[model samples]
Target chain A: MSLRLQARKLACERDDRWLFRGLDLDIRAGEIVRVEGPNGSGKTTLLKILSGQLADYHGELFWNEAPMRRSRKAFLANLLYLGHSPGVKAALTPLENLAWYQALAGEPDDAAARLEALASVGLVGFEEVPAGQLSAGQQRRVALARLTLIPRPLWVLDEPFTAIDRDGVVALEARLSAHARQGGCVLVTTHHALAASSALRRIRLGQGGDDAGA
Target chain B: MPGPDASPVSEQQAGVACREPREGTAVAVRATLKRDLVLMLRRRSEVLNPLVFFALVITLFPIGISPDPALLASIAPGLLWVAALLAALLSLDSLFRSDFEDGSLEQLLLSPQPLPALVLAKVAVHWLLTGLPLALMAPVLGIMLSLPAGSYAVLALSLALGSASLSLIGAIGAALIVGLSRGGVLLSLLVLPLYIPVLIFGAGAVQAAILGAGVAAHLAILGALLAVALMFAPWAIAASLRISING
Candidate 1:
């Protein structure tokens, strides 16, 4: 498997506290790498830097061996990022939400594909219900449904297991492994024990615990 | 531009089989426009509040100032312009607030499409919902203010053209303060000064048209301001959003 993303000398500090200095990272295809760290440990920050969202850091990120800035368009095109908030519009129905996301990703708006994705995420009967009316776990599912809607190489998910029910968690864990087995890389941050994941490779952020004592 | 099945565009040279499929900018722009329109439409109260404010402020002038037709006509141009400008400003706070709060703005930032183009599409929808309605509703309120006979059309035309620039300019301030909880007051402080030239020319257009002095100069200047704003504000708004999101 080829290396999809590599970070060299990544030094990031937030609020005058060094989250990490000279950190290096590498992820190859068919690997589900988990980022473990406490609150404010800069797990999200590191993901943002790699995904090309946050630039308040010192690092060189290469996608397929090309500098991220020089190839930002292609990098973003292949990246699928799921943040803490579900990224679902409260007013729009699940169908509308997924359709808009697909369109923004520059995919053809296929009603069948969106419906099928929603069903796979277990939002079958509630397709037309406004997302604001859905429960928190359901709302997160609406965001997770994006995974099935489009095919992307790199998935940077922050706390994907939060508020998810047992069934949803089991299904999601399986999906992550399935995706990695298909030659996609999954970089996730979660406290949920991925006990069933044989494909998991974890990198814990040590600065989070050290900075607390300082 | 690549079609629906956008072949993975790799900056790297030959033999790289990348599989990132992207839709064209036009499609992305259309989706953003449609999604925003639907969102605003569903929140009908937010959409209508500005127009109601416009009418209420215009309604207050006769009772608060003077009911005399002659007196009202003399001051109507400036009053109408100022009221419309405030109403447009009232809607600006919510423009990026919801997107920022719900994390949709982050997704927008991460899109393969250029940020400025996507931002422009959103501002277009804002203009359509807020600016266009205010312009159309002004003529009715103009009658209340005893605006001159022929200048009613000019009032609508001036506002329709000028408010486009207002939405564009106001959006930059909206984006800058989107991360703040109490941005409504600061938004006005940041945007009001920039709105001066637009207010001057917009109000001036109707006043000139009312006098039958040929409003071409005033209207032309408003158009020029709109042109300048159109060219620059989207990029500014995009940059501000990135800063706000990162911080």
Candidate 2:
């Protein structure tokens, strides 16, 4: 419950274009920060940098008090990063996918409870179907199903609600809210405005860098 | 290295009561073999397709070249081995392409199990599917090429060992080129040279056996190549894959 994600003078580039520069941000436990920006404004890149997935950026990112460069794997192990792609294997059933993902995350929790978590995401009846056959929204639901079993404290999501239907989006918001209420921290990027039930903070990536706009 | 079960829960959360289980390299290797076997079974056609291609290429050689038995026998080992190498190369694209495209590769990268272990499992699977079947089929095709029975064992053994080396080495190439446009042809260009050592020794083994010379030396070379690839390719390929995905 003592996790802290902070960045100072962080700058990033994608394909030689400066996406963001000289950005500073801080989020402690119990804060849900939302990153909103225009298309191709580097919301995803910033999330990846924060999640330790992309590390070739300039300036500093600190997890707790240590430099992110020194403790990357340790940092990544505690962060759950869900990109625009749900990252579910299409050939495997939803249940099978979740089982493997839970193992990948090094969670040793009960598989039965994992299945129950899938059910919690309203994927009970479709658990046996391969994800390739599922609709886009359903596939997303299966990906989000990981939240039920894994216990990582930080969730970094990029456009997490993209393909989810209206009802699915609402359900996901509730899950994010519950996660934050339980002393977890979330950093997400989205185009759609999230409802106010969750105490979600906001950070908008403008033409310059991350600041309090939009 | 510690086993998957022995991995610490957290960097700082050590000194817990229970001792973590340690799965050694042997268990990791066995688990890898099992997973590869299952994947091969599920994709049976993909496994056999390369063998069929190998057989087809050998079949064409007889019609494309002289049908005389002596002439065909003289070059059969090298021809069949080259065709098999190319066939293996043709299917290398499928090794990580599907998984990468479907997003499964990302999940694998995130796995607590070492990425190298998972990559070794994948390379093993590729060898089982594409390389092993070609080795098994080479003996049957060798007869059509008029390869002597005495040399057939050498051919099969060399191919079995050598094609495995190809898969391991090719994995690095495949991973490096996974996300690029026109990657398949580029991959061939990158890996085909690396495959030459395996080919030279594999075909040379059978050729030496045909000459009534000691084929053991040639077979030993192929085995050494396989061993080297087995030791290094997994780590290199895993690193290249991470770089490619992150890029």
Q: Output the number of the TM-score-best candidate.
A: 1
Which runs in model 1 stand beyond 4 Å of their true positions? A1-3, A196-198, A208-214, B1-17, B20-23
Question: Candidate 2: misplaced stretches above 4 Å?
Answer: A208-214, B1-40
True contacts kept of 2: 0.16
Enumerate the candidates' DockQ scores in order: 0.38, 0.22
In candidate 2, how many Å is residue A127 off? 2.0
Query: On residues A133-172, what C-alpha lDDT tens digit does candidate 2 reach at each position?
Result: 9999888888787765666777888888878887778777
lDDT of 1 at A168: 88
> Considering only the true interface residues, what is the Cα RMSD of candidate 2 after superposition?
9.4
Candidate 1 lDDT over B136-194, as tens digits, reads 99999999999989999889999999999999999999999999999899999999999
Residue pairs whose backbone atoms clash in candidate 2? none
Residue A88 error, candidate 1, Å: 0.5
Error of 1 at A208 (Å): 5.1
